[model samples]
Target: MIEFKNLVKRFGTRTVLNGLNLEIREGEIIFVLGTSGTGKSVLLKNIVGLLKPDEGEIWIDGEEVSQFTEDQYFPIRKKCGMVFQHPALFDSLTIYENVAFGLRRHFQLSEDEIKARVGKALNLVHIQGVEEKRPAQISYGMQKRVSLARTIALQPKILLFDEPTTGLDPVTTTAVNQLIQDLSKKLRTTSIVVSHDMNCALSIADRIVVLDKGQIVALGTPDELKRSTHPLVKDFLEEVLHA
Candidate 1:
């Protein structure tokens, strides 16, 4: 459902993504594994038009969107839901309002419809009984789930998660990874998760793409990656093995 061809992204003197090409199938869960400064997040932004590539094209559902104007990208962005490294929730809004915010702004829905979507989204993330609570009143992990609830409320076809497991304890991280797997199957949405956790990738990803500097150094399923002889892939596997 998504394809990048000869993609190149640069920031003044630095080229973060260089001649990268990747194709993601619909209903697939892809894990992007890379160290910092490897253009993992940049790749996600480019997909949703939050960032544009300097060279080559990005195709989604057979449409080339590299040169799409903001208005042209409106629907594309709407079809994509991104969960950032941090839960960028409004401190002032209750969890219910936060989840309902996108629905209110993007679609003309009745109060009853909005309420139902918010409830369902929360339930999909395994969250419950915190609708009236503000962000500050919830645990950090719960707050993250609320953020996810907000994204899924829009019923997006593509889910872009940048460091979804960051800042969580191991137990919470494992739970979140399993949730990603469950949601992908339940909603049949394409998921691209940018993370450094090879362990989680192995447990949940349909495939893993490892990036180095600006290129894909390795790409394979978890078992293939585990058997890979590439030095960087070996290093990542070692970390996972010893973790």
Candidate 2:
């Protein structure tokens, strides 16, 4: 469903992605694993057109989006939804409003339609009865669920999660991971998750892509990654396991 061909991105003198090539199939849950500053999030942004590549191509569902103009990119973007490390909820807006925000911007739906979709999304994330509360009124974990609901409400064909389990307690982290797994299966969306959380990656990924510096160094199933002999991959596994 997504392909990156010789993708390169640089910031002034620094290169973040160097000839990165990858293909993500439909209904697959892909986890991008790497240390900090390894361009995992940069890759996600490129896929959704938030950051245009300095060189190479980005194709989504068979169309090259690398050279798409902003107006041209709009519809392409609508096929995808992103959740940041920080939930970034509008504090003034109620949970209902927050989830409904994207729908309001992108579609002409009635109050009843919006409410039904928002409720369904919240339900998909196992959240309920907090529709009237502001973001600040909820626990941080709930805030993350709200963020996921917001994205799910858009009915996107693809979901990009940047550290979905970050900044949560262990139990909450597990909850978030399960939610990602469940939603991916339930929604059957092609999902790409950018995370350094090894446990989360292991539990949720159908395939794992390991990045080092600015390029892909490994790609495998969880079992294959566990049995990997590559130095960087072994070191990463050892570090996370011992942490």
Candidate 3:
């Protein structure tokens, strides 16, 4: 489980997160939803030590992530995986090498082990037989799946997704959302996804957290979110419903 306690982040004069408190349970799919610039991505970064909060702590599986040094944070980071807003694959590397990159860099695994792991990860995401292709050679949706495959290659206990369905068409978006749900259930990984896509959120989230102006304005299941009386949440849902 991940816990955010009084977390705060600021950039000079601007405060991006304001004493945010959240608890993400183990083996659950959590969706952090909000309008643009509400610090959802920043919160995910803090959980994995990519960004240090200005105040308070981020606890992952009972360990305080904020206290870990760069070297110490490595092992902890290894236990966690991330899928960025953009498919941040190395364009120069082939799909197999890219997916196996983490295993090669971090583990002392043999060539056969790396090959097996990479192949299994790709197969998990239903993107087999693309190992020789470069990132630029695949479609955007395919690239996203490859990125997801790379993330799962680490066999992480926790998976952090930053806007997983951002730029895809509705059908492709649905495919990614279903993959997220399937992966979380199959692997029992604690999945925390930050997204503005309400459909994706409603589809995969066990719980939804709505952030507005650096604070959690609402937190509930999809049904609860739809039934919420809070004007901010209702307004957001109404807009999505109309759109």
Candidate 3 root-mean-square deviation in Å? 1.1
Candidate 1 lDDT by residue in tens digits, 89-193: 999999999999999999999999999999999999998899999999998998889999999999999999999989999999998999899999999999999
If the candidates were sorted by their lDDT against the true structure, best first, what order would they fall in? 1, 2, 3
The residue ranges of model 1 lying beyond 4 angstroms of the native Cα positions read none
Write model 3 residue lDDT over 37-77, tens digit each, in one string. 88999888887888899999888887888878999898889
**Of 2 and 3, the candidate ranking higher by lDDT:** 2
Q: Name the lDDT value of residue 57 in candidate 3.
A: 89
- Taking all chains together, each candidate's TM-score versus the true structure is 0.99, 0.97, 0.97
Candidate 3 overall lDDT versus native: 0.90
lDDT of 1: 0.95
Top candidate, metric TM-score: 1
Q: Please report how far candidate 2 places residue 210 from its true position, in Å.
A: 0.5
- Expressed as tens digits, the lDDT of each residue in 1-243 for candidate 2 is 999999999999999999999999999999999989999999999988889999999989889999999999999999999999999999999999999999999999999999999999999998999999999999999999999999999999999999888889999999998888899899999999998877777887999999998998899899999998888788878876897
Better of 1 and 2 by lDDT: 1
lDDT, each prediction:
0.95, 0.93, 0.90
- 2 against 3, candidate with superior TM-score: 2
The stretch of ten residues in a row with the least summed lDDT in candidate 3 is 195-204
Extract clashing residue pairs from model 1. Answer: none
Error of 3 at 109 (Å): 0.6
